[model samples]
Target: MIKKFLFSTLIALCSISAVNAQSKVKETNKLEDPDNLASQYFSQVMGVAVDATSNLKLYKFIYEWIGTPYRFGGNTQKGIDCSAFTKAIYDKVFNTTILRNSRDIFSMVNPLPKDELKEGDLVFFKIKSRSITHIGIYLGDNRFAHASSSRGVVISNLNEPYYSRYFYKGGRILDSVKDELIEE
Candidate 1:
């Protein structure tokens, strides 16, 4: 009777240990999954649904550049300007090159209405100028990523009073334009 009881207790302990180990492995895998981690981090940062961060390349690029100091005509990670940031994202995430300045970039896009804006579209702003002075990459949920002169690299909302007041238009680069740029 003693032997049987000890054997049964040993088996039970081993079974429990096996189950615990399996659960830990599953948790570790979930944590290690790059897509899962990116979705969670970007969803919180962008204030949007997790599914909205489906474009991992775009979000990861923005995430890595967040908090970079704003610089006029600067293009590197140490410092960058709004149009440069937009150009970098297009070149990296979308695999296309865009014009250097905000107004020139605006000319490359097909103008879109505010409500029609989609992820990866360009959101232009007048700011203090009569022409488009600032540009950002739209990240869905009315949020856009840009290098703000005041705030450095940050994600902002279209509905904010400052942005809403100056919001000029949203624009999407047409496939034909992308093809043309690629060929050049």
Candidate 2:
């Protein structure tokens, strides 16, 4: 009984430590300046050395994909939605898996005020309800890239009357997330 109790206590302690660490990371790392420790990773099997430049390539790739059609279950050059576009960028840039949609994505990151918005941060909107229904990548000059329903892919501004009213949350992923692409 004592051994079981000790094991349970250890597990509980570990969980608390993890939660605390996440909170601290969230507070310290701004979406604007995230750590980029992964840039030095080497793939000996492929005889390739990936570096910070990969992020730029990824960004340009996503930008080029602008105007692709929005499809329900899509992840191709042909079509994609807001969440899928964000996921595709992260997956390609950082080689990570994010939750499938906007609401789930919101919970994984920390929200920031609009003035702190940074490039690459996920911006969310509560279009239909309190739950976030849409997401986009924060591109500077107050513009964001999103897969609009009627417009396919598009760049939107926070100053836009429609988006300004629907704006709900702006989140910045912490550096310690061990995921998501962070441009160095």
Candidate 3:
């Protein structure tokens, strides 16, 4: 009985110390500049390496659309679908217009191998069926922003087990949206 009590007390103390240390680390690392804070937060969320030139507009759309509720065939902040969300992002950030459906966009662009994916490239997934059923914008460093059927708009790692398994291909819009491709 005494041994059990002592062990429980030790575990509780260790857990509290760990929580405190994590809070301290978070406090120390908090960014002051809004741009820097956004960049840092997105880098961590997307599992990407952010630099000075990281696209702020992309982050802008992601932050704006985050937590939107999913709705089939919808295209507004009140509710949105995956393809609609992708199209809106491209239209807003890149000034590029894309097809409103996942498969159409997949068919429209130059298909690329996963290894060749870059920021602004479209990442496609075949979640339920064999055809491309979902799409997201790649944000480099193996991260992509997508509107999930359940979770709405979110940034997720391509290497995540579920996404990795469903990932079909990456698509680049150089030819399709040549005039709108933002030259960096």
Q: Which residue pairs in model 3 clash with each other? A: none
Model 1 lowest lDDT segment of ten? 45-54
Error of 1 at 35 (Å): 1.2
What is the C-alpha lDDT profile of model 2 across 95-144, one tens digit per residue?
Answer: 66678889898877889878888767788998868788899877655777
Cα shift from native, residue 171, model 3 (Å):
0.8
lDDT of 3 by residue, 1-184 (tens): 9999999999999999999999988776665567788888867765677666888888778878989988998999999999999999888998787889999988779999999987889999998798989999998879888889989888889999999999999989857366545442
Best by TM-score: 1
Error of 2 at 21 (Å): 55
In terms of lDDT, the poorest run of 10 residues in model 2 is: 39-48
* Separate clash counts for every candidate: 0, 0, 0
The residue pairs in collision within model 2 are none
Candidate 3, RMSD to the unseen true structure:
11.0
- Ranking of all predicted structures according to lDDT, beginning with the best and ending with the worst: 1, 3, 2
- Report lDDT (Cα) of residue 107, candidate 1: 87
